[model samples]
Target: MNVFQSLVSSWQFWAVLSALAAALTAVFAKLGVKGVPPDVATFVRTIVILVFVSSLLFVSGQFSIVRSLSRRSVGFLVLSGLATGASWICYFRALDLGKAGQVASIDKMSVVLVAIIAFLFLNERLSMLATLGVLLISAGAILVAVAD
Candidate 1:
């Protein structure tokens, strides 16, 4: 199989691509925010993302799913979108004033926060190893954020 077929077959491929894209986002946003306010930059980015994803949804016939979403689902999605907007604004501002690696490292502490929040709010159970993994990730994020 060619590389495209191999990547399509791997479940992990999407995560890897997401990581790469996220890294590029930081770099590009950092550059784009050089003279612009972070909030404005985020707004522009959000518009671009909205258009791109909306196009994808229409092209892939996924827009039909919207009508099936219940009020609760729509409300939760709106809340999530607001949270994402806030996160992007903060992330872009952080990138503007800090090194990308340091900013991104600190941002990743959200993973640890998510694990704890999931356990507490979602009642999601983590195995001992997963708990340890969260602890390790938390420690590493702290170390990276504080490193000279």
Candidate 2:
């Protein structure tokens, strides 16, 4: 099977797992900034992820995943990691400066950005309903941010 079919067929096995992972990420971040500075808390978070992932690699005998990455791939991985770190920093800073509802609402606007980027750069097409949905998401995000 192609990767997409493989994923769809196995999705019932992974859906809850993915949802739980998302929940843990949100909860941990909400709790993380409670006492710690957002930047340092973000650092602690990266360290925790590294520890957990490295342990999983060791325990699962998947060291080949770590070892097989080529130097160019390693550079791309590092760049992606840095970008994620920067996003986390900005996300927490937004939450630290504003309400969680507002920050999350604004963050969800990334969906619209991704859709537009895909359309522009990849020549992807959106249906009329999809275009309307993007506009609605953007409008809702603006209201969420501006609402008192």
Candidate 3:
């Protein structure tokens, strides 16, 4: 396979893309919330995301599965949505008040949190090396957040 095809096929590629997009989100959101209230900015961002994702679902014919989803699936999705909304509000507010890099650094501490949470609740296994990496990520995030 060509390099581009191989790269696009890997989960690592998508994760890297997500990281880059998140980095841009911090920069763009910091700028966007300059004069606006963070909550209001979050609302606007939510609307845009809703429209964009809805359109993508519609065009991809994925909207048809909405009614086929189980009640439990819907319930968890609702909870996830609530959590996402809360996180976005807090993230935007942090961006409004702090340095983008520092805010993003702390935000990325979610990685460590997820690793622990997954191991506890999702029965995911973490080897010693992975645990050490998580510890390093936590330390790095803390150091970056506290750095002048």
* TM values, all candidates: 0.89, 0.74, 0.94
State residue 65's C-alpha deviation in candidate 3, in Å. Answer: 1.1
In candidate 2, stretches whose alpha carbon ends up further than 4 angstroms from where it belongs are: 1-24, 70-72
Q: Which has the higher TM-score value, candidate number 2 or candidate number 3?
A: 3
lDDT of 3: 0.95
State residue 10's C-alpha deviation in candidate 2, in Å.
Answer: 5.2
State candidate 2's TM-score.
0.74
lDDT of 2 by residue, 83-128 (tens): 8888899987876777776787787788899999999999999999
lDDT of 1 by residue, 23-74 (tens): 8987888789898998899989989999999999999999999999999999
Q: Global lDDT for candidate 1?
A: 0.90
How would you encode candidate 3's per-residue C-alpha lDDT over 1-148 as one tens digit per residue? 9999999999999999999999889999999999999999999999999999999999999998999999999999999999999999999989989999999999999999899899899999999999999999999999999999
Each model's total of backbone clashes: 0, 0, 0
Could you tell me which 10 consecutive residues in candidate 1 have the lowest summed lDDT?
Answer: 22-31
